[model samples]
Target chain A: MSLTIAIPKGRLGTQAIEMLKSAGVGESIDEKSRKLVFKDENRNLNFILLKNSDVITYVENGIADMGISGKDMIMENSADIYERYKMNIGRCKMSVAGIKGKRVFNDDTIIKVATKFPETAKKYFNGKGQKIKIIKLNGSIELAPILGLSDVIVDIVETGNTLKANGLEVFEDMYNISAMIISNKISYKFKRKEIKEIIELIRKEDTE
Target chain B: MNFLNIEDEMKYFQKMFLLRKEIENYLYEEGYLNIEPSIFEGYDEFTGINSRINRKSTVKLLDNNSEILILAPDITTGIVNKFLPRWEYGKKLKIFYYGKTYKHNGIGIKENREMGVEIIGEKNQNTDQYILSTAKQIISRYSNDFLLEIGNSKFLKGIMQSCSFNKEEYDNVMNLLYSKNRQDLKDYLSNLPFKNAMSTLLNILDLEGTFDEIKEQVEGLYLNELMQQGVEELSKIDNYMKNITDKVTYDLSMVSELSYYDGIIFRGYIKGSNKEIIKGGRYDSFTEQYGYKIPAIGFTVELDELIKVLDKEEQR
Candidate 1:
C-alpha cells in the first residue's frame, strides 16, 4: 500500500512538491496538472491536494497518513497530530496591523479587531491584557481598519505590500509562519522507520 | 438525505444503546452501582457550587413561585450535590449514570453526546489506575489501536510555582505548550533563566514513545522538588497503568482546560481523529466547592467517536 501524503494547495503546495521531489517522491506530482490525487507507481506514494487549514484535519483523521501545512493553521486548530518536521518554506509573520495613527491601547475605549483567524486574534489581544471585540472577516482584512470596521487586523504578512497598499501599518508581530510536515500519531508510531527515512531524505536535500 | 431516515436513525440509536449497555455492564461487573437523579435542580446547585457549569450552558427557567431551576448539564455535579451527602460511610463509591444532559450550548450534539461512569470516594492512585485501566479494556474490546495520553495538573502548577511568571505570561506559555507550538514555546522560554530546563520539560511533554522511553526521559529531568513530586506521582500511575495496558503514554506538560483538576488528567485517542475519544481527570477540588473536600477522578468516552472510528475501519 502507498503512503497517502496531503500537500496543501497554494504557495506552500509548490514548495511542498519540490521538497517531496527532492525526497525522491516527486514523480507522483505533476506541477501543471489540476488533478487532486497523484500517484507514484514506482515509489507507491500518493499525494493529495487539500486546503491549507484542512491539511491537519485530513492527517489527524487518518484520511491522509501525512500532510504539509502552515504552523499558524496547526496552532489555531490545535489538532493532536504529530509535527514531524518544520519545512521553513512560505515564511511569513502573523501580525496585528492597524491604521497608521490609531491608538491600540486606550483605557477608556475598547479596540475592535478583524481577522480571518478569530481564535489567534482573540488570544493575542487577551495576552496583551486588553479586551477587544473580534470581528471575523474572510477576506480583505486590510479594508477593515480603513473602513473603520476594526481598530486592528490580525493576518499573515509576507511582504507588507497589502498593508501598505491599504494604508495600514504592522503594529505587532505575533509569531513567524512556516510550513510544517505532520503525520497522524498512529502513522508515526506504526511507520516510524519509513517516516524517519523520508524525514532524513527531506532534511538532507533541503540542507544540500 | 435518505441515509438519515427513520430506519438509519433507529439503527444508530440501537448501536448506541447497546454500547451504553456494554459500558454499564462492564462498570457493574467492576462494582459500580447505577445512580440516576432528577433532571432538574436548583440553579444555585449548579452555579453557586461548581463554576464549571457556565451560566450560558445551563437551561434556566422559573418554577411555579418564580424560584430559579436549571436542567442538569452534567450528572456528576448532580450526584455530588444530591447523592453523596446521603452516603454516611466512607466506602468506595462507584456510580454509573446514563441520561440526557441538557446544555444550552449543546456542544456535544453527536460525538459529544455524553454518557459514562464517575467513581467517587476513592482518592488512591489505585483508583485512578483502575478507572483508566477499565476504560482501556472497554475501548480495546472495540478497537486495539488506541493511545491514552496522561498528565498531571500538579505538574503544570509546579512548573508555574518554580518560575517567576505573572498570569499573562503563565497563560501564554500554557496556551503555547497546550497547542504544541514548539517554536513559540521555545522562543518564549529562550530568554528565561531556566530556558534549557523548560525546553527539556517541553520536549519531555511532547515525547511520544514506548513506556521505557517515557520513563527514561522523565527520570533524567533536573526538576524542582515540587515538580519531582509530580513526576513521582505520574511515574507511580504510569507503572500501575503498564500492568493494565501498554498503550498508556505519559506527557508531563499536558494541561487541562478545566481549572478544577488538581491532580491527574488524561485523554484517549484512536489511530486517527482530531479530538480525544475520551477525556477525564482528577478534580479533587470538585467536592471542595460543595464543602466536602473529597478527591475524585473519572472519565467519559464519547462512544459516538469510537463508533465512527470503528465504522471507518469497517469500511476500509
Candidate 2:
C-alpha cells in the first residue's frame, strides 16, 4: 500500500513538487499535465493534485495520507490534521489593509471587513475584543475597500504589491503564513516509519 | 444525492442499537453491573472534575438556594460520589453505564451516547490487559483495520519533572508535541535548557511501530526511574495484548487532560475515521476525589463514530 500525498495546484504546487523530488519521494510528477493523479511505483508513492483550498479536505477525510499547503489555508479551513513539518516555503503574511486615508474603525464603532478567509478574520478580531462584520469575497480582495463593499480587507500579502497598486496600506499584520506538511492522524499512527522517513528527508534537504 | 433519507436513518438507528447490545453483552459476560447515573448533577460536586478540562458545560441556575446545576459532564465523578464510600475496599466492583453525556463545544450543544465499563479496586498490568482485550474484541468485530495506539503519560511527565520546566515552557513544549509541529519543536528545543534531550525526546515522540520495534527504540535511550517503569509496564501489557490482537502499536507522545489517568492510556482508530472509536486507560487517581483510595481502569466506545465509519465503509 503506497502512501498518498495531496498537493495543491497553484503557485505553491510547483515548489511542493520540487521539494518532494529533492527529498527523493516523488520523482515522476509531470510538470505540465492535466491529469490529477501521479504515481511513483519504485518509491510506492501517489500524488494527487487538487485546488489549494481542497488539499486539507482530502487529508482530513483520510483519502490522502499527507498534504502540503500554505498555513493560510490551514487557518482558513480550520483544519484539524496534524502538522508534521514546516517546509518554510511559500512564506507570506495575513494582514489587514485599507485605503491610505481611510479610518473606518473607531473606539465604539463596528468594523466591516472583507476577505476570503472569514474564519481567520473572525478569530483575529475576537481575540482583540473587537466586533466585526465580515464580507466574504472569493478573489480580488483589494477591490472590496476600493468599491466600498468593506472598510478593510483581510487577506494574504506576499509582497504588498497588489495592496500598493490599489492605494491600500497594511493596518495590521495578523499571522505569518508558510507552506507546511500535514498528515492525517490515523495515517501517522499506522504509517509512522514511512511518514517519519519522508519528513526527515525533507527536513534534511531543507537544512542544505 | 438524498441517499440518507428516512430508510437509511432508521437503519442507522437500528445498527446503533445493535452495536450497543453487543457492548452490553460483553460487559454482562465480564460480570459488570449495569448502573445508570443521573443526567443532572450539582455544580459544586461536579466542578472538581469539570474545571480540570477547559470545556464548558450547560449550566442552569437554581434560584431557590442560589446553587448552580450542571448537565453532568462526567459519569465517573457521579458514580464515585454516590457509591464508592459504601463499597468495601480491596473488593473489585465492575460497573457498566450507558447514557448521553452533554457538552457545549462553543458551536452548539451536542449530546453523545457513551457505553463504558469501570473497574474499581484493582490497577495492575493484568487489569489493563483485561480491559484492553475486551475492547479489542468488540472493536475487531466491527472493523478489521482498527489500530490501538497505547501510551504512558508518565513517559513525558518523567521527562518534564527531570527538566524542571516552568509552567509556560512546559505548556509550549506539550502544545508543540500535541500539534506534532516537528520543526518548531526543533527550534524551541535549541534555545531551551534541555537542548541535549531534544533528540531523545523527538525519537520517542515519533516512535510508533510494532511492539518489538518500539521496545527496541525505547531501550536504546537513557531513561530515568519513572520512564523505565513506564516502559516496563507497557512492554508487559504489550506481551499480553499480542496474544489477543496484532493491531497494536506504541506512541509515547499521546497524552490526555484526563489527569485521573495515572498510568496507561490508549486510543483506537480505524483506517478512515477521523476520531478515535474507543478510549480507555488506568485512572487510579480518580477514586481519590470521592475520599477513597481505589484503583480503577475502564474504557468507552463512541458508537456515533463507529456508525459513521461503518456508513462510510458501506458507501465504498
Candidate 3:
C-alpha cells in the first residue's frame, strides 16, 4: 500500500511539492488541476492538497496519514498530532504591527486591534496590561491601521514588505514560523519504519 | 452497526463494571476505602473548582422548592463538599470512587465515567511522592510505554506573584508559556522591568532534559526562595520515582486544568497519543468552600481514553 501525505496549499505547497520530488517522489501535482488528490505511481505515494490550517486537523483526525503545516498554526489550534520533523522552510515571524510614527499607548484603553490571529493579538495586548477590542479580519490586516479601524495588527512578516508598504512597523515579534511535518498519532506508531525512512530521505535532501 | 444498540450497550456496561471492580480492588489494597455521595450538590460548592468548567458547562436545575442544584461535574468537589466532612474527624482519609460526572455540552465526556483516589489530610512532600509513585505503579501495570509528566503549578504561581502581575497579565503569560510560544514569552518579558528574572525563569521552563540534568541546571541559577523550594521538592519526587520506573519526567511549563491547584500536578500519557489518559494534582484550598480546611491530592483515569490507547497499541 502507498503512503498518503497531505501537502498544504498556497506558498508552503510549492516547497512541499519540491521536497517530495527531492525525496524521490516525483511531482504529479498539476498546477491547474482542480482535483485534490495526486498520485506518483513510481514512488507509491498519494498527495492530498489541503489548506494550511486544516493540515493538522486532517492528520490528527486520521483522515490523512501525514502532512506539513506551520508550527504557529499547530500552536494556535492546539491540535493533538505528532510532530514528526521540522521542514525548516516557509520561514516567517509572527509580529505585532502598528502604523509608523504613531505613539503606542501602554495604558488600559480599549485599543482596537485587528488580525486573523485573534488569540495572538489578544495575548500581546493583554500582557501589556491593556484591555483590547479585537477586530477580526481575513485579508489585508494592514488596512485596519490605514483605515483607522484598529490601533494595531498581528500578522506574519516574511520580508516586512507588505507592512512597510502600508506604513506599518513591527512593534513586537511573537514567534518564528516554519513548515513542520506531522503524522497521525496512530499512523506514526503503526507505520514507524516507513515514516522514519521518509524523514531520513527528506533530511538528507535538506542537508545537500 | 450502531454500538449504542441495547445488546452492545449491555456488553459495554458489563466491561465498565468489571473495570470499576478492578480499580476499587486495587485502591483497597493500597489502603483506600470506597466513598459515594449524592449526585447533586449546591451551586456554591463548585465555585472555582475547575477553570475549564465554567458556569456554562454546569448542568443547573431547580428542585421543587426552586433551589439551585447542579449535577456534579467533578468528583473532587463532591468529595470535598459532602463526603470528606462525614469522614472521621482528626484522622487521615484515603478514598477511592467510580462515578459519572455531568457537563452541559463541551469539556470532557458528556457524562464522564471516572475512577479515582483521593488522599486527604497531611500536607507534606512524602504524600506527594507516595501518590505519584502509586499512580505510576497502577498505570504501568496496565501499559508499559506510558509517560508520566510531573509539574509544579506552585512554581508558576510563585513566579507570577513575585512579578506582581495582574490577572490579565498572568493569564496571558500562562497562555503563551503553555503553548510553547517562545517568541511571545520573549516579547512579553521584554516589556517588563524584571526582564532578567523572567528570562531566567523562561529559560528554565524551556529546558527539557532528564530529572537530574534539569535539577543541575536549576541549581546554577539564582531563584527566589519559593522557586528554590519547589525545585527541591520536585527533585526529591523525581529521585524517588527514578528507582521505580523510567517512564516519569518533569515538565516545568505544564498548565493545569484547575487554577486552584497549589502544588504538583501530573498527567499520564501513553506514547503516540496526544490526549492525557490520567490527570490530577494537589489542591490544598479545594475544601475551603465546604467550611473546613484540608490538604488533598488525587487523580482520575479516563478509562475510555486508556482503552483507546491500548487498542491502538494492540493493532500496531
Candidate 4:
C-alpha cells in the first residue's frame, strides 16, 4: 500500500523535494512536467504538487495522507492538521511591522491593520486585550502602512532586508515559523506505521 | 442559510428527519425511553467536569434577578440530571434523545440537531458492546464504508500520572497531541524533567494498528497498575468486537476532553468526510459531580456532517 504525501509548489518546494530524495523517496519528481501528481511505486509513495495554501485543504480532507507547508500558513488558516516534523526549511517569523515604529499601540484607538493573516492578527491583538480593525490584503502588505491605508501590517518576515527596503521595521514578534509536515487525524491512525517510517526517514535526513 | 442551494438544503433536512425516525424505531424496539429536556437552562447547571460547554459558548439571557439563563448547550447532561436520582439500584435505563443543542462557535451561535441514545446505570463491557454495535449499525445506514477508532481516557491519564509531569507540561503535551504535532511532541519530550518516564510512553503515542498488533506492542511496554487496568479493559472490548465487524482500530494519543469521557472513547468516520460523523464514549465524569453517582455511556450522530456525506455521495 502506498501513502500519498502533498508538497507545496513555491520557495520551499525544491528544498522539500531534496529532503524527500535524501529520505529515500526513490524517484525524481519531474517539476517541469504538466503533471500535478507523481507516483514512486518503488518506495510505495505518491506525491502531489499543490499550491502552498491548498496543502492543508488536501491533507485535512484525507486526499493526501500528509502535507508539507509553513507553520505561518497552518496557523493563519487555522487548519486542523498534525504537525509531524519542523522540516527546518523556509524558516521565518510572523511579526507586526511598520514604518520605523510609533509605539505600536499603548491606547485603543481602533488601530487598522493590513495583512493576509487576519485571523492570526486578530488573535494576537485579542490576546493583548487590544481591539483593532483588520484590513486584509492579498499581497504587498508593507505598502499598506506606507500608503496610509492602515496603521501597520502583520506578515511573515524572513530577513530585515525587505522591511528595511520598504522603510518598515519589525515591532512585535508573534511566533517563529518554518515548514512543517502535517497529517490528517484519521490518516494518522490508519496509516500509522507507514507514516511513521517516512517521518523517521525524513527526521534522519533533516538532521543530516 | 448560506449553503449551496435550496434543493440540497431541503434534501439534507429530509434525510435527517428520516434518520431520526429510524433512531426512534431502533430505540423503541430495544426498550428505551424517549425524553425531551427543557431548552432553557441555567448556565451554572452545565458547569463541571465532563462539561463541554463554558460561559463563553452559551447564548444567555439576563433574568429579573440579574442571573443568566442559557439556551441548552447539551442534552445528555440535562437528561442524566433529571433521571439519575429517581433510578432504582440494579436497574439500567436506556434513554433516547432528539433535540437541537445551542452553542457558540468561533463565528456565531449555532444550533445542531443531535440524535442519540444513552445507556445509563451500567458500567461494563456488555454495555460498551451494545453501544458500539448500535453506533455502527446506525452509521452504516448513511455510509457504506465507515471506520471506528477507539481509545481509553483512563489509559492516557494513567500514563500521564506515571510520568509525574507538572500541570503546565502536561497541558502542553496534551495540546500538542490534540493538534497532532509529532515533531513538537518529540522536542517537548526530549527535555522532560524525568528521564525514566520519557522513553516507553513516548513510543506508545505512535503505536496504532489492529487490536492484536497494538495489544502485542502495549503488552511489551512497562505499564503502571492503572495503565494495566485500562489496557485490559480495551482488550476485553476488542475481544467483544470480534464477532461484530473488522473495522475496529486502536490509538494511544486519543485523549478525551479534560474531566469528560472517563473510560472508553471512540469516534466513527465515513470514508470520504473530513469530520467524524458519529462520536460516542463512556463519560460518567459528570454523575459524581452532580451527586448522582450513576455511570453513563452514549453517542451522538452529527446530522449535518452525515447529511453532507450523503449529499457528496449523491452528487458523485
Candidate 5:
C-alpha cells in the first residue's frame, strides 16, 4: 500500500519535497514537467501538487491521505484534520496591518478590514469584542487601506518588507504560522504505522 | 445516453437498498424488530427534550393545528420517548430501526439513512458488553479494514469534575477536544494553576494504544477520586471487548457531540474513507429524560457511507 501526500504548489511544495527527501521517503522531482501528480523515487509514496487552498480539501475528503498546509490556511478553512507535525519551512505570521501608528481598539466605531482570510479575521476581531466591517479582496490587500477603501488589512506577513514598502505596519500579530503535516482523521488510523513512521522521520529531520 | 435515458435509474439506489436490507436482516436475525419512526415531532417538545441537538438544524413546519412541528432529527430520542416510559419490569426491549433523520447542515436541509440497534431497560454490565460486541461484529461483517474506536465519557467527566468552568468555557473546552485541536488544548491547559493537573490532562489527551497500554501510561499521572472511578468503569468495558475483537483502539480524547452519551462511546471506521461507518454509544442520560432510570446502549450504521465503500469494492 502507498500513501498519497498532497503539497501545495510553489515554494512550500518544493520545500516539503526536500524535507521528504531528507526523511528518505522522497526524491527531487522534474520541476519543468507539466505533471501535477507523480510518484516519489521510493515508489511507495505518491505526491500530488495542488492549490494552496485545495490541499486541505483533498486531505479532508480523503482524496489525499495526508498533506502539508499552513496553520493559517488550516484555521481559515477549518477542515477536520490531524496536525501531525510542524514543518518550519514557511514561517510567518497572520497579522493586522494598517497605516503605522493608529491602533484599532474594540471601541464604538466600526472598523473596516480587508483580507483574503475573512473568517479568520472575523474570529480574531470577535475574540477581542471588536466589531468590524469586512471588505474581502483576492490579492493586493495593502491597496485597500492605501486607497482609503478600508481602515486596515488582515493578511499573512512573512518578513514585513511588503507591508513596509506599501507604507503599512502590522497593527497586531494574531497567529504564528508554519507548514504542518496534516492527515485525514480516518487515514491517521487506517495507516497509523506508516503515518507514525513518516512523522518520526520528519521529527528527526526537524531536530537535525 | 443509455437507452435514451429511459433505462431504470434506480440501479444505484437498488444497490444501496440491498445493502440496507442486508444490515436490517442481520439485526432481525439477532432478535431486533424494524421500527418505522414518525417523520414529524412537536418542535418545542423535541428541542426542549433533546438538549444536545442544535435547534437551528431541526426543520420546523406548521401543522394543521398551526402548532410548530419538526422533522425527526434523531431516531434514538423518538424511540426512548415511546418505549422507556411504559416498559414492563424485568423485560428488555430489543429494537432496531432503518430510517431517515432530517437536519439542516447550515446550507440546507439534509436527510440521512441510517440503521440502528438498541437494547434498553437492562441495568447490567452485560447489556453494555452485548451492545459493544454487536457493534464490533456488525462492522467486521462489512469490512475487514474496520476499526472500532472506544472511549468512556465518564473518564473525561470525572477528570472535569475538578475543573470548575462556566457554561461558555465548558462548551469551548468540549469543542477543542471534539476537534482534537491539541495545539489550542495545550494553550487552554496552560491556564491551569497546578502543574500536576495540567500535565495529567495533556497526557490523557495524547493517550492512544490498547486499553491496557493506555491504563499503564496514565498510571503515573495525577488521578483524583473521580478520575480513578472513571478508570475503573472503563476497565470493565475493556474486559468485555478485548476477547471478542482485536480491532479495538482506545482514545481518551474522543468526545461525542451528543450530550446524551454518558458511558462507553465509540465510532467505527474503515480504510479509504474519513467518514465513520458506525456511530453508537451509551445514551443513558438521555433515557433519564422520560422520568425513568433505564440503562440503554445502541449504535447506528450510516448505510450511505458504507454503500460508498461497497461501491468501491464492487468496482475493484
Candidate 6:
C-alpha cells in the first residue's frame, strides 16, 4: 500500500521536503503552486500540504497515514493519535510570557492567559494546580499582555525577539517544542513496517 | 450532516435492519440465544467494582430514592452483572444481544448500536477458537478487507510486574505506551533503576510485524513467571491464527485500559474506517467482581460504525 504523509506548508515543510529528497521518500513540493497534494508514483508516497495545525487532524482521522507537526500542535489537541517519532526540526520552547517586571504565575490570583493553544494552556496550568482563564488568540499574542487583554501568554517561543519587541519577557518555560511525526493508532498498526522504514530512512539522511 | 430526508432515513433503517437480521440469524444457528439488555443500571453498584468506567461520560440520573442510575454505557458489563450475581457452577450459557449504549463525548451524547455474544462456563482452547472464528466471520461479512489486531492483557501486566514501577511511574509509562512516544519513554527509563526491564519494555514497545514475528519477538523478551503465563495463553491459539497473517497483527505493547479484561484482547478495523468497528476480550476476572468466578469471552460489533462504513462504500 502507498503511504500518505501530511506536511505543514511553508518553511518547516520546505525543510521537510529537503530532508525527504535525501531520504528518497516524497515528490518535489511547490509551496507557491495552487496544487495542495503531490503524489510520487516512483517512491510510492503521497504528500498533503496542510496548515501546521491541520496536520494532526488529517492524521487523527486517518485521512493521512502519518503527519509532520510541532510538539506545540501535539500538546494542543486531545486527539488520540500516536506521537511516533521526533524529527526535532523546528526546535523551540513553549513559555509563559508576561510584561517585564510583573509576576503572573506565583500568586493565587485567577490570571487570564492568552494563547493559540487553549487546551495546551489549560493542561499546563492544570499540572501546576493553578487557576487560569484562557483567552484564545489567533495572531499577535504578545499584544495581549501589553494591551491588558491577558495577564500572560502561553505560546511557542522561537528567538524571544517577538516577546522582546512587544516589551514582554518569558516568565516560565513549559515545554521544549520541536517537529514530530505522528500516526493514527490503527494506521500505525497496519503500516508499521512502512512507517518504520520511512523514519529510518529520514534518520539516515539526518545523520548524513 | 443531519439534513437527510425521510426517504434517506428510512433506507438507512432498512439497510441496518437487514444487516442485523443476517447477523441475528447466524447467532441463532450457532446456538447463541438473543437477549435484550436493560437501558438503565445502578451507577454506584458498577463503579464500586470497576474504576475504569468513565464517570463523566456516563449519563447519570437521580432516582426517586435519590440514588444514582446510569444509562447502560456498555452491553458486556450489563450481561455479566445479570449472570454473575446468581450464577451456578458448570452452568453453560451462550447468548447474543443487540443494544444501544450511550456515551457523552466532549461534543455531545452519542448512542452506539452494538451486537455482541458471550460464552460462559468455558475456559479451554476450543472456546477461544470458537469466539475468535465467530468474531472474524462477523467482521469479514461487513468488510472483506479487515484486520483483527490481538494482544494479551497478561503480557502487559506481567511486564509491569517485572519492572517494579510504583503507581505513578506505571501510569506515566502507560501514557507513554498509549501515545507510542519513544523519546519521553527513553528519557524516563534512563533515570529508572531497572535496567533489564527498561530494555525489554522498549523492545516490546517497538514490537510490530506479522503474527509469527510477534510470537518470536514476544518469546525473546525477558520472561518472569507472570510473563511466561501470558506467553502460554497466547501460544495456545497462535498456531491456528498463523494462516491469516496478513489479516492480523499481535504485539505486547498493545495496551487497553479496560481493566476487566484478564486475558486475550482484540480490536477489529476495516479499510476506510479510522475507528475500530469491533472490540472484545476475555473477562473472567471481571466476572469475579460479582463474587462468582466463571470463564467468559465475548466480542461486540459496533453496528453504527459498521453502517457508516457500508454507507460510504455504497456511495463510492
Worst 10 residues of 1 chain B by lDDT: B105-114
Per-residue lDDT of candidate 1, residues A1-208 (tens digit): 4577898888889877887787777576886788889888786678899888889998988888888889889878767777667766878999988988775754457888889988887777776788889899899889988988888888999999988988888988998888877887666545555766676777776653
Enumerate the candidates' DockQ scores in order. 0.26, 0.61, 0.14, 0.54, 0.49, 0.82
Per-candidate alpha-carbon RMSD to the true structure: 4.5, 3.9, 6.8, 3.8, 3.1, 2.1
Q: Which stretches of candidate 5 lie over 4 Å from their true place?
A: A28-32, A41-43, A102-105, B1-8, B41-58, B62-69, B84-91
Pick the winner on TM-score between candidates 4 and 6: 6
List, residue by residue over A21-78, the lDDT tens digit for candidate 3. Answer: 8777746786468989988887677889998888888887777778888977886676
Backbone clash total, candidate 2: 0
lDDT by residue (tens digit), candidate 2, B1-316: 1245899778777888898898898789888899887877787667666444544556455747878877766566667677777868578788888977777876776787788778888776678888888788878988999999888877776777776778778877877777677777777777887543455676766566776877778766767887777788888988898788888988787767555676788988887787888888877777776677788888888878888888888889
Query: How high is each candidate's TM-score?
Result: 0.79, 0.84, 0.70, 0.84, 0.90, 0.94
Q: Whose DockQ is higher: candidate 1's or candidate 4's?
A: 4
lDDT of 6 by residue, B26-145 (tens): 999999998989888889876765565678888889999999998888878788888788888899999999999888987988888989999988888888878888888888887788
lDDT of 4 by residue, A61-87 (tens): 899999888898888887777787787
* Cα lDDT, model 5, residue B67: 100
DockQ for model 5 equals 0.49
Query: Could you give the CAPRI-style class of model 6?
Result: high
Q: How many clashes in each candidate?
A: 0, 0, 0, 1, 1, 0
lDDT (10s digit) by residue, model 4, range B1-316? 4558999678766887887887789878888788776777776766653343346778888789998787877777677767766767777888888888888887998988777789988886689888989888888777777888888787777878878888678877887877767767877888877654466567666656677887777766777777777788888889988888888887766865435677888889887787777787888766776566778998888877777788799889
lDDT of 3 by residue, B193-240 (tens): 773357555675544446776777676565777777777778888888
TM-score of model 2 (CA atoms): 0.84
Residue A160's lDDT within candidate 6 is 99
| A185: Cα error in model 1, Å | 6.6
**Which residue pairs show collisions in model 3?**
none
For candidate 4, what is the DockQ? 0.54
Ranking by DockQ: 6, 2, 4, 5, 1, 3
Candidates' lDDT values, in order?
Answer: 0.74, 0.80, 0.75, 0.80, 0.81, 0.84
